[model samples]
Target chain A: MNWLKYIGIFVMLLFLQVFLLDNLHWLGLVHPFIYLWAILMLPIELPRWLQMFIGAAIGMVMDLFTHAPGIHMAGCVMAAYLRPLMVAGYVQDIDRMKGAITITAIGMGNYLRLLAVLVVVHHTIVFMLEAFTFSHFGFTLLQIILSSLFSYALILMFEYLRKNT
Target chain B: MRNLLQLILRYSNFLLLLGLEVVAFVFVLRGNKYQQVAAAGAANVVTGSIQLMSDNIASYFRLRADNAQLLEENARLNAEILELLNGQTRKRDVNDTLSTRNREPLSSQEAPYIRADLDYSFIPARVIAFSEDRHHNYITLNKGSRDGVTPDMGVIGKDGIVGVVQSVSTHFSVVAPVIHEGIFISAMIRKNDYMATLHWHAPNTRRAALEDVARHVDVQLGDTIVTSGMSAIFPADVPVGIVSDVSLGEGDSYYDIDVALATDFNSLRTVHILNYTHRAELDSIQ
Candidate 1:
């Protein structure tokens, strides 16, 4: 039943993103990155290797829709590889956790920590791919910062709503 | 040796990530023209839909401005017609008689105005959406190939040059606006007759730079710039812009001058597509 729910969420998020939020641009460069929801809501107990595989699949699908080749793939795999580390780094004592990876299960502070880390890592990878050449290093950094700020804010707003409702 | 192996194993994921990034880079670099066309087309559709949605919301806000500008332009055209009626006007012949004479029989009188002879004329189109983005700045017009629009036709606004038709569909066409980096216009100084190419720098829409003018040509600030007619796309003597500044490039002989374009593209709503009568013959020869 939980597996079906996850699939439902994935399909819904992808459709909303590809159709609705895809064209909204903020600050001329920043866009609502609802595609990252696929990575953000993955199972905490999933094996590290399997998580990486799922991340790659989602990223490849996003790449197909965006026509951005491997940018999403790079971001997703990076987030997956770091997910375990970020969770471990945030939760000092795993024994104190009664987590099913649900919105209410994970405490708000720790949840935000994981979200921030993944958002940063994913945005960095995506921005670097967009700016393949390092000649405009300063501009690339600015783009990453601006885009990540808006994307992170949007994701947090959605999560906040999920927590309340 | 054991420690080295451990380090490699620990960072293996990073290495894999690096490898994947390299592959993506290669894919983008080697992406075919068809792929680019598909991506651009998709992006255009997405933008077009968004513009269409917002256009409804903002249509009320723009109606008054659009109406006033139309009235002003109508009055200007009416004044020009009145002047022509009074025999005080010097109208240039639109026909390509010089080139036609070379191919066929000799004629002394200049060719008659083709504009009056053509039964079919262009449909004035509204620019529904446009881009000022640095890399690719194209415009989506309300009319397209179905309206007799075709690639290589010239687009002109009330004040001056807008761009050329790049692609066309049934109800819409994309223009490569003069503000785009890829667009170039054959322009000349009206005072001294020195010719050069005009191009946009992407950062500014109001101004473009002129190139290939010799340093010795007499020039001044506010010198009128016009189309050369060297290219069949734009008719000769169409007002392009006015010279705002002039300077010499370092270690270069040609003078570089800044021109303030006559047409304010930011506020441009209606545009006319200029179609040369002899376009088919010119294309066949070329």
Candidate 2:
């Protein structure tokens, strides 16, 4: 594991996200950079413990920047915790996929499986966190669905970019 | 001992996930409480800077409209000046002015609309942003704590009540509009002579409803409703809204009357954050 390389990517992604994308309010209140995709896109060979730790760290940095305390952190850790289960579900022959889990290597079906789980978990945690008081469950659900769709679309766009590059 | 060790090792990640999630949950539960003012203070700085830049751009567009309005106002003032001069000149020429003045009574039916008293020497402000959403409805203004706009200051436009100043920073303030579920203004129907609470149902931005008023009142459609002035927030008889419809149901205790608000929240360019001299004194006593 290249510790320096992972740390560099995390800082750069967070800096761009909080400083640049955070200010970009598209259509009043919608900007889904989903740069946390960098963490989710980490190699499957990395230890599960290390992955969860890194996920928590990355989420903390995002929360610090955005003033949203723990929602992002919780989302990232959940995806990290569930990554193996999701990957195992689709990879019938993990050896055939070159032992590397790039979107192209895993195919669109598996890629979407990972993406859907991560996005749903992230958005659910975020929206539920926002509606922490529980006075407006219906409104909170609406926020979750809307924000999740947008965030998921952005994550997919990033995946497409990574595949093309 | 070996089985217990294996179990602990196997479920360590789940425990870690729960631990991190608990930390995050704690933050969410304590959301916007301890660090709210601090977060808001920081956000205010960023919002202030952005608002300053946007205000410059918006100010450029507003200049032309402002000039036109000023010109129109000047024209009206000039006409009034001419009429006053003509009346003065006519009075000077007429030796029979006493008889003409005596013919008209001191108290006539042409009384002007009684505007509630407000302090004239307070800071002026303009509405920069208005929320159309139901969940978090509010309006941002161009003045703040530096402008003597503290939280809970009464706001009004030319026609009627606008809202109360909710939060204030160095150069900006957020107003909780009458349409927000947060506000409860003590109000009374003018025609029906019944007191009730006015609140926003949130789906409609322009309309709010009267609550707790009994069904026995002789409420007519289009009757004007004004503030009861029971609270020190707003002055007495300040025009609030006009009754659009009153729901007369079989089981409801109060009339579910929809009222079209007097001040248009969408198009509100400028407003007055009323700072009364007697507000603090009155509030403390009450």
Candidate 3:
């Protein structure tokens, strides 16, 4: 039953990422990658290997959709590896079955901080790899900042909606 | 050995992360040049089908705009046909003797006056995916190798030139649109025949620059620019754009001309791919 729920979430996130979020070219700058929600919402106590594998799989799917083969996979893998470190101090006890390591369970402030750090880290690596050089450093940095903020805001909104409902 | 094994086990997660990242980096490196082409060919097979499905749904909402553009093109073509017919009738009435003379075999000196029939055919294709947000924009079309689309074939929309086909799969082709920084077409001012090269400079979709026209040419705002047909890819006299602005750089020998492009790429849906029959012969001779 628990595995079924995670699989369902994975499929839903993949569909949303490929069909919806990837197509939204808002201002040609901020592409809200809310698909990261799947990795971010994983149970805090999940095995690191499994989490990293899931992140890489999701990233590969995104890369296939965007016609960009590997940059997203690299970024997502990095994010998955760093996930525990980001939430280590805040998440004292992780509920495995409920898997409520989300914003509602972790408090808003700490959740936002975790979201910001991970998003920035992911976007920075992704954009840098996409650019492949420091020649367009300013442009790449701007993209990373704008896209991270946009993704953070979208995740926050979803968290609020889930809490209220 | 025991200590080393324990250390490896303790940091196994980090090692796993490194291994995955290395694999991803390999994928990126493989996507650099020649390998990237192969990857894109494979990627297109999957992405093309998905784009085709999405385009089917999205095309419904764009029917009105597409219809208007087709109507406008139809009207223009009708006017051109009427003009041609009128000129033919007037020429027939003006000179029966001269018309008879025109039928006679032309001398070697008059060979240049003989016009060869256009050797081009068009294959219609619908745009399944288009992006103008990037510095290097690409357009994906529904027609591909199976439909006779090949690399370097010119694509034109209703209003003007779109781009050249860059790559092709079994059922899809990718176009390097004129908006891409790398695309440059030989163009000329319609009024004076001053030749230049058209290329995208600004990020705006509706604008591009015409370069290399001499400073002495009387270029003005609102002057029409058309393809020069120097390259056999596109036919001559296809409308490219109107000159929106022109300026001379200090101490420079050429004019910096800005053109408002004829094709509105944002609303592009359907295009015609030009197939030049004599392209191989011409290429071989060149």
Query: Which candidate achieves the best lDDT against the true structure?
Result: 3
Clash pairs of candidate 1?
A: none
Write model 2 residue lDDT over A43-85, tens digit each, in one string.
6777778878878877765654444457677778887888766
RMSD of each: 7.4, 7.9, 6.0
Model 2 chain B poorest ten-residue lDDT run = B104-113
Cα lDDT of model 1 by residue, B83-166, tens digit? 655542232244334333222221101111212333224457888766552323566787766788887788877677788887
Q: TM-score (0 to 1) of chain B, per candidate?
A: 0.75, 0.73, 0.77
Q: Candidates' lDDT values, in order?
A: 0.68, 0.68, 0.78
lDDT per residue as tens, model 2, B81-179: 587578757876885454443322211111112232333224468876555443335677889888888887778775688888777788887777787
What is candidate 3's lDDT per residue for A75-163, written digit by digit as tens? Answer: 89988888776677776554333464576667788888888888888888887776677765777777789888888888788777867
Q: Candidate 1, after superposition: displacement of residue B205 in Å?
A: 2.2
Residue B34 in model 2: lDDT:
25
Backbone clash pairs for candidate 3 read: none
lDDT, residue A50, model 3:
86
Q: What's model 1's lDDT at B175? A: 79
The true-versus-predicted C-alpha distance at residue A158 of model 1, in Å, is 5.1
Stretches off by above 4 angstroms in model 3 are: A1-4, A22-24, A42-50, A93-101, A127-142, A162-165, B1-37, B88-116, B182-202, B209-225, B228-232, B245-257, B282-286
lDDT tens per residue, model 1, A25-88: 3333565566786776777677666777788888766765454456677788888778766666
